[model samples]
Target: MPDTAASSTHLTLLDDLLKRALAHGADAADAVMIRSDSVGASWRMGKAEDLERSESTDVGLRVIRGKKQAVVATTDLNPAGFDELAERAIAMAKVSPDDDYCGLADPALYATDLQDLDLDDHPDQGAERLIARAREAEEAALAVKGVKQSEGGSASVGRTTMALAIRGEGARFEASYSASSHSVSCSVIAEDGNGAMERDYDFSSARHFEDLDSPADVGRRAAENTVRRVGARKMGSGKMPIVYDPRVSGGLVGHLSQAVNGASVARGTSFLKEKMGQKIFADGIRIVDDPLRQRGLRSRAVDGEGVAVRRLNLIDDGVLQSWILDTSTARQLGLETTGHAGRGTGGPPSPGPTNLYMEAGRLSVDDLIADIQEGFYVVELIGMGVNYVTGDYSRGAAGFWIENGRIAHPVSEMTVAGNLKDMFRQITPASDLTFRYGVNAPTLRIDGMTVAGA
Candidate 1:
């Protein structure tokens, strides 16, 4: 049962896969094995709505023949299927189009410093605990005076074991022992005098159950946000200082992440493609990616290619310093890999950021907004109207209006538009940064954005 639940046997299978690929007319190959177990529950209106549990074990093989490459994935763990899997991958590679930049990372560049990131929290949080947590979240949300109904409250626990194996200059193997996650969320609806309704939600997640915010706190926050949005009115259109709450402000940095992604830059599809080594943000702005943060949601010791991953200052003092790169994209640009390769079970590695965040400035959220006389403080954004290719930005937004340097009234049905190229340059971050998501930023105040409304 221990072996079934989790095992190091995948390491042996990786070697077997690589050997079979070489025997089947392949020059090189890599394998990835993933095993996952998860359980979840949802509670609504004081009753359990559903209980769910699942387990899946899957493996993928990628083969290279000269300049051609192919990938195949399967769930059949029967050792009998691996040989056929390798043969089929090689056959596909034989007819595949040649990609000049496709190849394994240089053997000399493999990560040697294995760091324990404390990613997994053991003693499995059982199904009963998950359901109980869900019930607590729902009851707490419903307890709020103005909250009319609970959209739903949910709790989940999941664990994953991952291994990567490759045959390149020589054989190499690395495996993520395990990663576990716990999450709880609640949503509530509130009604205004005229029966108009508004809904809001909040959630907390962590690698360890103990790190999650109290279920009551999550529920109360959801209720408070929903009630506050009731009967929101529209604001006038104008170009003004736009403030971003930490929740949605991270999106601004998210756009920056996409702009600096190596794949997009290599394909000539990014707005900042030619802006390398140039000042992209305000002089005080700094952006970083850290892959070794203990308990971080996106933390990892090594990238998909087993390249040594480390923290990088992607944007240092406003200058674009690095492109998130994997071996493939780095080669295409005639540069060295930056160890930013991210992969999945069915696709080639892609360059992406992990635990990306912006450094905070020496200003509180209130202090950051104190200077704004007439501005929009965004709490919610709807729709995807961003165009990274041209740096154009437009989005549906709702939040509060800052009047005389204070958040005054709830506002909705407004549209905010600007060019990201300008947004980044004018953004000033507050000193309230928190690492709560894959991409995080503090409350930010951006100057000169067009807010359109009544």
Candidate 2:
């Protein structure tokens, strides 16, 4: 656990800033305070390459006068700077444009429990240790049979402490949280004897150092994947099932996130704007946003607006059930906030997801693809040719080909095109869901996509 006393100190600063804003002729206000420490190192070709470390503090003040709000941020936290910053913010609010739906969140929704979420960890390492990690990872990758050139291996770690405080009509409170992370990665090229080459990479991140994958293992995985990609050929143009590997499948769910964002629905620009309570995916499909998950990469004890966030069943049994909503977006659509408010120093609250993932289905990956006579198993997505408003999807893709329910040669330089609305309805998941990123899905299969070829 992070030092409770340190968090309290930071929270006090935020509390004082909010009070200062209210004292300076603002009707209500909130403040964000952050402190961070980071370190990184890199190595290549059996030698140390570089090292870096940094520490910083940032504080931002947002003051509301009646229906207007203004925000200001600074790295200077001097007592003298605090008063001037708050006074300036209040002054700016007087000339700001008015908004009917802008203000503090409903006081009743404020978070009270702050300590139960385990969002912090301790990683004790310096330049020497980081460099050693990078060196070992690169060495492991270069040891692989067909692995040739090293793109370098790297390691990084960081710690951050954040606090938010709010003051309104009769409500006043503050919440603080801390986060720590450690990660190692490697990228390398694999060369075939006939002068063909391919590159791939793997990485792992965790709140605690001990939870990270071994450096050697990360490097080995990267090299193995790259070596497997050597001599990749092209497939023919046709309509076929496109299976998404776990590494890249999360992006499919990300598209769903954007479609269901309340802001898009409010503006009538999302393809899924009118899809509420409708069956949008195959039966048994479910997606969730969980903010209280222990050590989650995007977990938060309280939301960006000081509201108590909760787990949301965004998609329930293949039906579109909810929109990711913040206080303002929800009001625009005549609904309650879904506890998805996210904000930074100089902007209004916006809807966002936290620890989002789709539930696994009942079939193993092998079983899921056993019936495919010919298909493409995607490994990497190259560009963003997505149209959220029209639901059109086109992107450069590379992966292996599946023939007669078995893996064939690797394929590259292909384009997959389809409509997301149609793609969602046809997507079938395999029971291999592993929580590896902020957005995660298992091996997924989509039928009837037009795969453009060489």
Q: Estimate each model's TM-score.
A: 0.97, 0.98
**Residue 79 lDDT in model 2?**
67
Error of 2 at 386 (Å): 0.9
Query: What overall lDDT goes with each candidate model?
Result: 0.88, 0.89
Residue 283, candidate 2: Cα error in Å is 0.8
For 233-291, candidate 1 gives per-residue lDDT tens digits of 99789999999999999998889999888899999999999999999898978999999
Candidate 2 TM-score over all chains jointly: 0.98
Candidate 1 weakest ten by summed lDDT: 1-10
* lDDT of candidate 2 over 1-454, digit per residue (tens): 3367977888877877887888889888888887899999999888888788999898888888988989999898776678899999988899999978888888888877764666666678588888988988898999999998999899999998887888877768777778998999999998887898899999988887878899999999999999999989987999999999999999999999999999899999999998899999988999999988888888887888888899999999899999999998988899999889987766667898999999999999999999999999999999999999999999999999999888898999999999999999999999999988999999999999999998
Q: How accurate is candidate 2 locally (lDDT)?
A: 0.89
- Candidate 2 — which residues are off by over 4 angstroms? none
Identify the candidate with maximal lDDT: 2
CA deviation > 4 Å runs, candidate 1: 1-7
Clashes of 1: 0
